[model samples]
Target: MDGRRNGRKASRRVGPPTNRRRRTGAAAPKDALVEAVRQSRAATTGSRVVELMARRALVVAARQLLRQHTDRCTKCGSTFVTHEPAFVHCHYCGRMHRVANASLLEQELFEIRMGLRLAS
Candidate 1:
């Protein structure tokens, strides 16, 4: 039996056997997944905060314009007022002033835009 006559050939393309240990009880993968979830939640919360801030800014601007248009308290002639639902209350005299309907504000804004266009 010549050595060349033996037919078993080692495959060079085969990878070496691994001595690496298998993962234990999915705990390591779970930690990575938990971190990913936490990061995604943080990103969403940041976006929500930005959205809330924009809405607050719009409300403040509208409130300022309304206060300017009605620049005096009819009861006490004082300008100090606080906004409530569909009304503005005088702080100095405990009087309630009825604001126009919300749609009326939209109409007023439209007329102001038209006036600016005509002016230009």
Candidate 2:
């Protein structure tokens, strides 16, 4: 379009410029911080699902383990405990049975006597 707008004239620098140094590939602290934050978030988000599942499974297993006993209905003598709070209802005779938790020592002794240990 014009003599000044030519590629040769456009490539000319005004001066030597303030800094005569060139930035290396490993330069810039701000970029490094940004990359570190991105990587940390990615690592945590990826393993979050595994952490939640493990915590849920632990709580469920603890609940099951705490329910150490089931009563037998007086009328039918069936140990088939059911319902929300585990009110042992006899299917045969239609009766509700009362249950109680044994002492901590007794439970431990019983577990030892029965060779009961963690399944895992």
Candidate 3:
């Protein structure tokens, strides 16, 4: 019968009302998923860079050896011409080789040539 009693009954009947317009202020799950993808891509790219560097180093070493002996295989001592780059093959060993760092190979070739001249 009292006003306070009626207000309490009305509040209890309706229960608590939820706010429909309040921002959740939390990052979406998709955003976290995207961040994870980005991190994975970065890791993959870093590993690829390392792999490329190793390949380059191997190529440089091979080139240096090739330059040291123009007509001979570095691995098996088979003879060939410098002009035929692709056709060059170690007949005895049958290994394929390629030159990558031409400048370094040339320098090494010069050093070896000079050393042989001095030795003679």
1-120: candidate 3 lDDT, tens digit per residue:
554664674344366787767677976799898888778966658654433558878876766444433577767776743423223446677765554434644544655665833433
Clash pairs detected, candidate 3: none
Q: For candidate 1, lDDT tens digit of each residue in 54-80? A: 888888666544433366776689989
Q: By TM-score, is 1 or 3 better? A: 3
Worst 10 residues of 1 by lDDT: 60-69
* Stretches of candidate 2 exceeding 4 Å from the true structure: 1-68, 79-83, 101-120
Q: What is the number of backbone collisions in each predicted candidate, taken in the order shown?
A: 0, 0, 0
- Evaluate all candidate structures by whole-model CA lDDT and list the values in order: 0.62, 0.55, 0.57
What is the alpha-carbon lDDT of model 2 when measured against the actual structure? 0.55
Could you list the CA RMSD of all candidates, in the order they appear? 24.2, 22.2, 24.4
Score every model by TM-score: 0.26, 0.20, 0.29
Candidate 1 local lDDT, residue 86: 45
Task: Enumerate residue pairs that collide in model 2.
Answer: none
For candidate 2, write residues 22-120 as lDDT tens digits. 676776699898888778966758755343568878886555332433555545567665532323446767764433443555644555665764433
